[model samples]
Target: MALIGIARLASESELLEAKSRVTYFEIAARRILNRTKPNMPFQWTINPYRGCEFGCKYCYARYTHEYMELDVQDFEDKIYAKPAAADRVRLELRRIDRKDHIAIGTATDPYQPAERRFGRTRSILEAFARERGRHLGITTKSDLIVRDLELLREIARANVLSINITITTLDEKLARLMEPRAPRPALRLKAVRQLAQAGLVVGVFPNPIMPLLTDSERALDRLARRARDAGAQYFGAGPLFLMPCAQKVLLPWLEDNFPALALDYRKLFEHSAYLGSGAKRILRARVEKIRDRYGLNSGPLEYRPELWLGEEQASFELRD
Candidate 1:
C-alpha cells in the first residue's frame, strides 16, 4: 500500500480494543527519536504512542493530530500505538550520544490506558534498562507507572532516570473537570510517594497552571506541601499557554464551567498563546516562595554522566 493519505493510513492501521471508551490502532513507525528544539530542556524525546486518552481540556499537544490531517478530537478519541517501538528505540539510541538527554511522554502520555494492553512503554523501558550512562526522564499522570517500578529502578542503577508525576491540583473535583479521564489527583500523589520511597528521583510538575483556577498562591502552596509530604524532591509549575487547537476545546469548557472567567481567558489569549509578562512574574514569585517554604528544588537536577575517554584523546584517536 502506498499510504497516500491520512485516511488510507488510518484504514491500514490494525485496531485493537482495549476498553469500551478507548481504542488502540497499531501503526508502523519509521523512527522513534525526535530531536528537540533549542529552547526545550531535553535534546531528544520518545513517545511510544500518539494521542492521549486522558482528554485534558487544556491540553496543548492537541495540535499534533493536525499534522496527520486528522481532526483535533482524534487526538483523544483515536489513539495510535507504534509497532516495534522497543526495537526502533533501541536502534535509535545507538545514533544518539549517550550524554544527550531523552525525555519520554513529552507529547503523549506513554502510560495511558492503552499502555496497559499494548505494553509499548514497558518494552521501551526494558530496552533502556540494558543501556548505561544515559540521562532519561519520564512524565505521566497515571499511577500505572508503578507497574514498571522494578525496571525503572534497574535503569536508575546504570542510567540517570527521573520520574515526573504531574498533579494539577489537590482538589479531585477540579482535576476531574480539567483532566476528565486522567487518574485522580490522590492516585498521582500516591505514585509520587511510592517512586520516592523506591529511592528513585521523583518530582511533581503542575504544568499549564490555569489562571484563576490553579495559579493562586494558596493553591500552589497546598500542592507543594502535599508533594513534599509525599517525598517529592522538586516542584515546578508553568502557566497555561492556549494555542488555537487548545482554545477550541478549552474556551467552550470555560464557558460551561467558569463562565465569568471565560471572557477574561479569551481576551488574554486572543492575541497570543502565552500569558503576559506580569502574570508570569507573579506566578514565578509565588512558586518560588512555595518551593522555598517546602524546601523543594525548583526543578529536576541535570544528570551528567562521567566521561571516561577525554575529548582530546578521542579526537586524536579519530585523527589517527
Candidate 2:
C-alpha cells in the first residue's frame, strides 16, 4: 500500500519532463453532505478526488493535506482518487430531506490530469445525472472540463450548474512557471468560450490575485476583457494569501525566479499571511471598480463569504 504523502520532485528540469503518466487510489471519506443554506450561492457539493495535478506554484489548496495530517505536499503531485465518491454521494443524497446543491473541486480539482487516467470525473457526473442535485458548481484550471460538455448540458438544462475556470494570467511565460503541469492559459480560455456557448453559466475566477504579480490594475483589466469577449458571464477576483506551509514552499520558488522582489514579499506578507480585513476591503473595492470599468462584473462580489465546510484551506505567497 502507498503511504499517505506527496511524491517527491526529481529536479527542476526533471519536473518539466512531461509524460502522460499518473497514479490513482481510493480514499475512504467520513461523510458526504449537502450545503445548508445561509451563503453566497449554492448548497450541494462533491469532490471526486483529493489533491490535484495542475501543479500551480501558488495554489492555495496546499493546506488541504492537514486533514490527512500532511503538509506542503504541492497539493498536486500527491494523489488521492476517491474511487467510490459517486456511490457515496448518491447514498447520502437519499437521506437528506431537501433538494441539495453542491460545489465540486472546492477542495480538489475534479478535472485534474489524474481524472483523465482514472475516469473518476466521468463516473461522478453520471452519478449526478442519475438523480441530479439542485445546484452544482465546479472550479478548476483545466481544459479537461470541455470533455464533459455533453454531460453538463443534460443536467444543466434544469438544475443550477456553473463552471468557474480559474485564470490568474494570460501571459504564457508566467503561466508556464506558475502552473507547470497545467494546460496553457489559452486552452482554458477556449474551454470557457466553448462551455459558455453551450449556454452554461461560465465564469472566470481571477482569484488569489497576487499582491505585486498578476494583481496589477492592467493585468485585471486585460484578463477581464478577454474573459468577457470569450463569453464569461461573470468575473470574480481575490488577493493572493501566503498561508503558513505554502509560504515555506512558494517563497523559495519566488526567490529563485524573481530574486529582486523576494524581500518585498517578506514585508508585504509581514502584517499577515491572509489579507487584513481593511486590506481586503480596499482591494475588493478596487477590483470591483476595475471589473465595472471593464464591464466584467456579473453581480455583487463577496470575499471569503463564509468559512469552507470543514475543509482545509491554504494560502499563496504575495509580493509587496
Candidate 3:
C-alpha cells in the first residue's frame, strides 16, 4: 500500500479498538537513518518511531503527520513503529563515515511509552553497541532510557555517546500544563542524575522555552540550578518555535490557560515560526548566565574516540 493509504488504515483501525486513547501500528520502513538538513549540528538522525505519545502542547514535529496525509492530531494519537529498524540501521551505518554524528530521537521520542512494547530503540542501541568510534547522541524526556543502561554503557565504551534529557521547567504544575502526558519534571531530573551516575555524559535541554511561561530569568535559572544539582554536565535552551501545525494546538491551549499571552503569541509568531532575533538573544543570554553560574557547559560536549582520530587525520591529510 502507499504511505498515505497505510496512514489512513492505521488511523481507522483505532476506531474499532475499545481500549486506550492511543493506537500502535507496525510498518516496514524503507530507511531509518535520515540525513539532517544542511547547517544542522548533527549530520544524521534516527527516529525508531513515527509520532509521539507524550503529546506536548508545543510539539513542533506535528508536521510529520502531514506527509502521510494525516491530521496534525494524528501525530499523537497514531504511533507507527518501524520493524527491522535495527537491521536497517546497521546497514545504513556502513554508508556513514565514523566522523559523522548520528542523533537518535530527533523527531520522535525513541523511548516514549511505545518503546515498552516495541523495544525498537533498545534494538537500535544493541546495533550501535557492536560498532566502534562513531558519534552517537540520544535525546528524550522519558526515564525509560535507564532500562537500557548497560547497552548504552557498552556503546559508550567504543563510541562517543551523549544523552540529552529534555526538561522544560522545574515547576511541576507548569510542566503538567505544557507537557500533559510526558513524564513529570521530577522524574526527568531523577533520570538525569541516574544517567550521569552511570558514568554517561548527560545534558539537560530546556528547548522551546515558551515565552512569558518558561522564559523568565528566574524560571530558567531555577531549572538550570536543579539540573546542575542533578549532576547534569550541560544546560541548553532555545525559544519556542510555533510552526502553523503547532500553533493550531498550542494557541487554543494558551488562550484557555493563558489568555493574556495568547494574543502576544499570535503576534509574535504571526509571520514566522522563529522568535525574533531580539527575543532569542535575550533568552540566550539569560540561559548562558545561568549555565555559567551552575558550572554547566552551553551544550552537550562532543568527543572523538581514539579509533576515529586516525581516520579523521587521514581525511585531513588527503585534503591537505
Candidate 4:
C-alpha cells in the first residue's frame, strides 16, 4: 500500500532493535516541538518516541498508531525513537516565546524502554539544561527518570521544571493488573522521594482514577498520604476518560478481571469520554479533602528557580 505523512516515515525508518514481540525503529523527525491548543494548560508539547512499552490497558494514546496506518495494538509493540533529538529541540527553541510552557511526553512516555537504548529523552533534557529560561514538565510512570538526577537538577536550576509521576494505586497487585509492563508502585514512589530530595519540584498524580475500581475514597486517601510521605509537594487526580480506541482494549480487560464492574463501565462510557458532572464533582471533593489532610498542594507548585537568568520576572503556576 502507498503511504504518506507519518506512515511513510514509519515505513522508511531504520530498524534499531527487536526483542520478542517488541521492535524498535529510528525515525528522523522534521521538528521536535508542537504548539498545543489554546485551551490546553500548556503551550507546547514534545514526545521523544512514537509509542510506549508499558502497556497500560487504559491508555488513551493507542490511537496515535493509527496515524501510521498500523493497528492500535502496535502502539506498544512498535516503538519509534527520534535521533538527533537534542539538536532538533535546540533549533526549534527560537520559534516559541520564552514564557510558553513545554510539556514533554504528552502523547508518549519520553523515558520508555526505547529511551534506554536510544537516549532520546536524555538528549532532549540535556538540550533543555543549556537554556536559561523556559517552563518545562515531564510525566512518566518509570523510575528510570532517577537515572538523570544531576541532569534534571541542572535543568531545574535554570528553568521552572515540574516532574509529575503517575501512580494510579499503591496496591501492587492492582498496579500490575492495570499497567502490565510498568514499574512497581514502590519503585515509582522511591523515585519521587529521590527526586524531591534533590530539590526538584515533584508531584504525584493518581490519574485516570478508574471508576468502580480505584475511585474509592479509601484508595485515593491512602495514595495522597503516601505521596506526601514520599516528599511529594502536590497531589492531584482526574477521573478516567475512555475514547473508542482505549475502550477496545480496556473493555475486554475489564470484563476478564472485574466481571462485576464490566456492565457499569460500559454504561458510564457509552455516552461520553468524560465522567458526568455530578460524578466528577464528587471525585474532586474526595481528592481535595485528601489533599488538605495530607498537607499537599492541589496542583503544580508555583516556583521560580533561584538560578533562572531570564529577564521575565514572574512566578509561574505550572500545570499540565
Instruction: Using lDDT, give the best candidate's number.
Output: 4
The digit string of per-residue lDDT tens for model 2 on 1-320 reads 34332221111012212344544455544454435346645454566666677766766666665545555563565567654457866787677544455677766788888777777777777766766446667888899998999999987876667788989899999889877877888999999999999998898988778777887778888888899989997888877767665677678888999887788888778767776677678777877887787677553233242345344211111112
Which is the leading candidate under TM-score? Answer: 4
Write candidate 1's Cα lDDT for 136-200 as tens digits. Answer: 99989999999999999999999999898999898899999989999999999999999999999
lDDT of 3 by residue, 1-320 (tens): 44434344344333212137887877545566766545456777777877899999988777667656778898888887766456667887899999988888867899898898879899889889999999998999999999999999999999999999999888899899898889999999999999999999999998868899888898888888899999999986777878888899999999999999999999999998888999978877888788889999977633211111111111111111
In model 3, residue pairs whose N, Cα or C atoms come closer than 3 Å (at least 3 residues apart or on different chains), thus clashing, are none
Superposed Cα deviation of residue 103, candidate 1 (Å): 0.4
Candidate 2 lDDT trough over 10 residues, lowest sum: 7-16
Q: Between prediction 1 and prediction 2, which has the larger TM-score?
A: 1
lDDT (tens digit, per residue) of candidate 4 on 126-213: 8999998999999899999999999999999999999999899999999999999899999999999999999999999898799988
> Number of clashes in every candidate structure?
0, 6, 0, 0
Query: What CA root-mean-square deviation does each model show from the true structure?
Result: 7.5, 7.2, 7.7, 7.1
Error in Å for residue 316 of model 4: 30
Q: Which stretches of candidate 1 lie over 4 Å from their true place?
A: 1-8, 301-320
lDDT of each: 0.81, 0.69, 0.79, 0.82
Model 4 worst lDDT window (10 residues)? 307-316
Q: Better model by lDDT, 1 or 2?
A: 1
Ranking by lDDT: 4, 1, 3, 2
Off by over 4 Å in 2: 1-23, 32-44, 97-100, 298-306, 312-320
